[model samples]
Target: MRIVDVCAFYTPHGGGVRTYVEQKLRIGPQLGHEIVILAPGDEDGVVERGPNARIVTLKSPRFPLDRKYGYFASAEQLHGALDALAPDFVEATSPWRSAGLVADWAGAAPRSLVMHADPLSAFAYRWFGQVFSRRTIDWQFSVYWEHLRRHSRRFDHVVCANSDLSRRLAEGGVPRTVTLPMGVEPGRFSPLNRDPALRARLLAACDLPESASLLLGCGRLSPEKRWPMVIDAVNAAGQQSPIGLVMFGEGRERRTILKHIAGNPHVRLFEPERDRETFARILASPDGLIHGCEAETYCMAAAEARASGTPVIVPDGGGAADHAGDGAGMTYAACDPAAAARAIATVLRSPRRQPQEARTITQHFAELFALYEDTRARVRMAA
Candidate 1:
């Protein structure tokens, strides 16, 4: 079976969606399927091709609305590409302009749309007022949601990354909404592969002493991620433990966060690690991962951290709770810095029970890949 993944952004440009597509492409061939990715061109250049999958670049001019490193592709160009590929199945990550082209190319083949984030999540930054005004954010979300509601109807299957997204789709009257948790590459993230020297070097480079308990928060440094909360939690926790906070990822909120932590000696921010190896190294070295984001389809960083035998301390609500798993980590009420701080401290002082269990429980990704294989088989039968 041949599967074409349509998304407005791809690897080296996008986040979880990009990684998810790339993982599918890597593993699909082993399950007897070919995968192709279609995404917009960025300053970084077109995606580098690989054996299991080929990346097709669709050029689009940069615009103001393309704020979050996302771009809109021309429908005509996308249709031409799909018509040429004639894939057995089409999987779209977003129901944006690119998704419209996928809908247009629906010909007899089965198509699926994977919803990684709720359209309303884009509006989450409005409250912070550092990125976009409330009015502008509202308008952006309204437009995106309206497009998703209409275009999503055309897909044979619609997958939501979590139950919240599934509920949102259900409310919008979308048919065939299935909740599929995102999977992590355990091979890359396992604790057994941790490089202690690399971890020590990263800590030293970040000006953190080996004795300091490091708390990591990995994700786009955006207002929605609520990074300030993590900083505050670390500050509060510093009273108890010698805590150093290191955050990975770059975004519009970098300057704001930098300014917020100007006088704080305990916090350090670094550019997002593009290489998976570096990311896994940081995950394994961190004492615990902190996540304050109110909305997350699936907390890829938290999952990776847990998979690396690092406990995750996430907020109570959101998709992350589902991924944290029972006994894998601690989940506190949203934005409670004290709770977040306490959770981190507790995890650091406690025995290695949770991290050990995390390694055992996170093998669910194998089950998820089985589902992906099954989906491909069904598509082949229909084809």
Candidate 2:
């Protein structure tokens, strides 16, 4: 089986979607599938080849108004590429302009749209912020919804990352929806590979004491992430326990988040380490992972942390619960700093240091991959 993946960006220049695609490309070959990637160009348009896949890049001019709008490559260009590759299945990771083109070009071929995030949640960022008025946000969301309504009917299947997203799509009258949770690479993010020396070095670099309790939050620093609530919780918690919060990842909310944490000696926010090994070590070394976001479809960071034997504390309402599974972690109410702090405190105070049953979570990924393969095979037979 040959699959063509259409995404806004590819690895080295992308985020969660790219990581998920790369994981599939790496593991899918073992299950008898060849994968190819189509992504927007950076610097100069050029083809870059990977071990199990080949990437085709198209030059996307960065518009002054919206940098992301460049993902809208010409339909002819996209169709030309699809004509050349003629993949057995085409998977679009976003509902962008390029994705619509792919669906049109795919014809009767199996085409799937994977919803990684809630479109409404994204709409809040794109238009409802201080930069744009509430009216603008409403208009943009309406336009987005209409666009999705039209193009959604074109795909053979719609894959949602969580039940929340699936519910939202169902409410919007989308057909053939399936919930598929994201996966984590246990080998790359295991606790067994933690380096004590690296931990000490990292703590020292952050001006944190070696004995201080460390709580970690890893994700984009944005409004949707609700990082301010995390900071507030840490501040409130510091009044009781000797806890220090360390956050990884950079985003648009950096200045606001830093200002909120300013003058608080117990909080430190920095960009993530370039190496995955170092990042995994940090997660393993932390006392617990703090997740403040309520809109997560499936948080890869939380999954990785749990797989690293570190307990996670997330809100009760989102897809994070699906990853928490069987007391491997705890869940708190969304936006409740006190509840979050209490959960983290409980995990820290507990004497039990039993290893988490992360193998079960890894098995979930294997099952998802099996399902994907099965679906792909059925699609091929029908085609």
Candidate 2 per-residue lDDT, tens place, 250-354, comes to 877899998998767667788877788778788788777888877777888888887887888888755776666666688887668899888888877764354
Which candidate leads the pack in TM-score?
2
Off by over 4 Å in 2: 42-52, 63-69, 123-143, 194-211, 351-383
lDDT of 2 at 217: 89
Q: Residue 36 CA error for candidate 2 (Å)?
A: 0.9
Per-model clash counts, in order, read: 0, 0
TM-score against truth, every candidate: 0.81, 0.84
Worst 10 residues of 2 by lDDT: 356-365
